[model samples]
Target: MAADDNENWEDRPLIMPFCGQSCWLVYQTLERALGRSVIIEPGLSWTLVRRQDPNMEHLAKITKCNTMVVLAEKLIEESFDPIVDRHTRNNMIQSVVYNCGSNFPRTNFSRFYTAILENDGRVISAASLRIPSPEIAEIPFIATSEAWRRKGMCRKLLEAIESALGDIGIKRIVIPSSTEMLAKWQIKFGFVNVDYQTNKNIKELNTLMFLKTTRLQKVINPITRKTADLNFLPPSSPRLPPAPPSGQ
Candidate 1:
């Protein structure tokens, strides 16, 4: 997606910058094009999960020989790349997107997203997804690490994911629900039972379809320059409803 001066970012990154075709390409565009995280609220910030090295140990645990403070060169400043060009910024942006296949949602799922609220400096919240076809995508979970339940963070996370999905031209999303939460998923979240077309695609879905889980899906409105303008309105500032019973 092209970056222009007139871009409205009130519900951004969540609304997805440069949202267009290809889910994987959408991920790449967000990292390189947007390259910034949104502070969702006073205390919460939204970002892709940070990627960490598998072999590295704790900072204090590293021996002086492999340490930072007393390193041979001026290591602290050396650690940061000089932002000389697009290459420098692009590399920096990639570090924020998590890539651990071993994590929740697992390796088979292609993309991982998170809704993080930093407290005293730490990141958290999560989701994982797989794109079975250009028109259909499957999501495994959305969760937060802190006691942020009922605070609308999950909605914000879903908005962000939906923004990207709609941007990439993915027409619908499928999520699995337990029988217990089916009502919440259907009524509260606006999901409905799978129809014939989605069910027809099941053979191609493989293990992406969870066993015994109630299937839920929501049709996405295709986002474009026109419709995207309304993408990320906050809860307090929703689009007005129609006037009713005017002559009753």
Candidate 2:
């Protein structure tokens, strides 16, 4: 969490335009350390919005602005290094709105989770995901500014996201991928192609996935961060007394 941003988050249900929610400030020891406030300023961070937050209109207003599409845009494209020096509301970690990609527009933006990196105040790299079901989480999009690519921005965000999700009791993560990038995603991200049958077994997957996209999955245990194959097969039924003893 940004040091300056932390000092101002009042002890109330404050609206965090950057984080896209009106949740209470996380001030306690174990809780704040375990939640989304784990990341820091000038680097990796995440913004979350749940299903029925009170600040939905505020979120829509900020996200609609094309202002801070990169680095950090605080309503007017300026990076306030020392937020305490400024008069804006206290937000734990400030990040401008960035929602894009194939499946992003289709899903309810109110439920998206974002990981972003900013420089000065502009968002240089970012990615997003949604929790359609407890069985799996889907990363619909990830992008880095052309100038910021290849510097490991997305990788850092990805790791942070996996850890955050694991802390929330979500153990599996998925991404909708293209055929050409399947092998590369597997090698670089520890993901495997979720076969068509397995995909169907996870019913909620079909709800949010785009057509013509390949599904890939990875299991990050938060503690172990281990890799595993897809496992949605139905339990096998016991044989019925050897077919009634050959028809008696």
Candidate 3:
């Protein structure tokens, strides 16, 4: 399992359904390693609205900003660094939001998951899932607070988002991930390198690597058909099942 944004997660842990004591311990381990206070809560719309102070402008910004079309506006405002950042991972969420929001309008902002925990009334160490296209939700970002680095928080958070996605009838997931860690996760999660590209001068920017969701893919079944050779088949015959042989 992995973590995604929605740190203000509800009173639920996003770990695999069958995850056991060891997994729970991992969460604690991460907390201890980061040495930052963390709480996982659901990213409720009402909660986000209430969290946004009475600054009408900021609310409007959230409402009108093209970037806010998805759920990562808050993260972007918090300032994102693509390099040396494990929690935030790459700016995958930002890139997905920017790309889609740049083309779509703000009112179309649909429901998505972001795992966030309130720290002294300031939301921090967040991650988000973009359902721009339902069948293929994109994990754009999964970041932990600077003080919260080296903790297993990010992975735990992603598991939470995946649970939400499953409940919502989503399947076939995709994540924009770093190339270096790609191999590590591939070994860990069975992901494969489908494609790769790059940009020079960009530090730690993942030019390539995508993590596919096996859980999500299982929800879909492929349609199959059998083809017959025209020359081998009897002319003008319907492709029907053969009749059973006479009983002895």
* lDDT values for all models: 0.46, 0.46, 0.36
Tens-digit lDDT track for model 1 on 64-178? 2122112211221232333222333322112212322433322223243333333333434445454555567666555554455576656666666666657656678888777
Model 1 / residue 136 / CA error / Å: 2.3
Error of 2 at 178 (Å): 1.1
Please give the lDDT score for candidate 1: 0.46
TM-scores for candidates 1 onward, in order: 0.52, 0.52, 0.39
Q: Considering lDDT, which of the candidate structures 2 and 3 is the better prediction for this target?
A: 2
Quote the positional error of residue 70 for candidate 3 in Å: 13
> Of 1 and 2, which scores higher on TM-score?
1
Which stretches in model 3 have alpha-carbon errors above 4 Å? 1-113, 117-122, 188-190, 194-248
**Residue 154's lDDT in candidate 2:** 67
Candidate with the greatest TM-score versus the true structure: 1
**Alpha-carbon RMSD of each model:** 17.2, 18.2, 21.0
